[model samples]
Target: MLEQTGLKVSSRYIAQIKKKCGLDVGENFNLPKSKNARQPQCTPEKKEA
Candidate 1:
């Protein structure tokens, strides 16, 4: 909307301004963590009988 009025600003700069105003800024990274990965990354290709 501001751009329509001839005002140009970058997203980074907008975040900086919002932060200065004590407002929530930046993207939400609330990713759900996976269950415990107790299994080892490497495993035997074939289990010896």
Candidate 2:
């Protein structure tokens, strides 16, 4: 978007500024899981033979 304003800035600098400004443009950190990620499971212990 800065290109429209004729402003020249690196993406790293823009990311830093965005973080400082508390913008929600970043990935959603509130999510507890990610897409395509597998869920955890537990196996029961075997009884004595």
Candidate 3:
């Protein structure tokens, strides 16, 4: 994404930033799981209440 913005950043710099933010810098870091199904939408009556 940074490349699309014409900004060149090294992996080491990214790792450093992640370390500063207390995030894991492991090569096999696992992202949090997301829901596979979409959430049910609220009805108009519910919104009015």
lDDT of 1 at 24: 96
Shift of residue 4 alpha carbon in model 3, Å: 3.8
Predicted structure 2: lDDT: 0.47
Note the Cα lDDT for every prediction shown.
0.47, 0.47, 0.53
1 or 3, which is superior by TM-score? 3
Candidate 1 residue pairs that clash? none
When sorted by lDDT, best at the front, the candidate numbers are 3, 1, 2
Compose the digit string of candidate 1's lDDT tens values, residues 4-49: 5444445545555566569998683753477663422211221110
User: How many pairs of residues collide in model 1?
Assistant: 0
The most accurate candidate by TM-score is 3
> Which scores greater on lDDT, model 2 or model 3?
3
List CA RMSD, all candidates. 20.3, 20.4, 17.4
- Per-residue lDDT over 27-46 for candidate 2, one digit per residue giving the tens place of the 0 to 100 score: 64555565876533322121
Give the alpha carbon lDDT tens digit for every residue of 14-34 in model 3: 665667679898773644467
Residue 18's C-alpha lDDT in candidate 2? 64
Q: List the residue pairs that clash in candidate 3.
A: none
Q: How high is each candidate's TM-score?
A: 0.42, 0.36, 0.44
Candidate 1 displacement at residue 14 in angstroms? 0.5
Per-structure clash totals for the candidates: 0, 0, 0
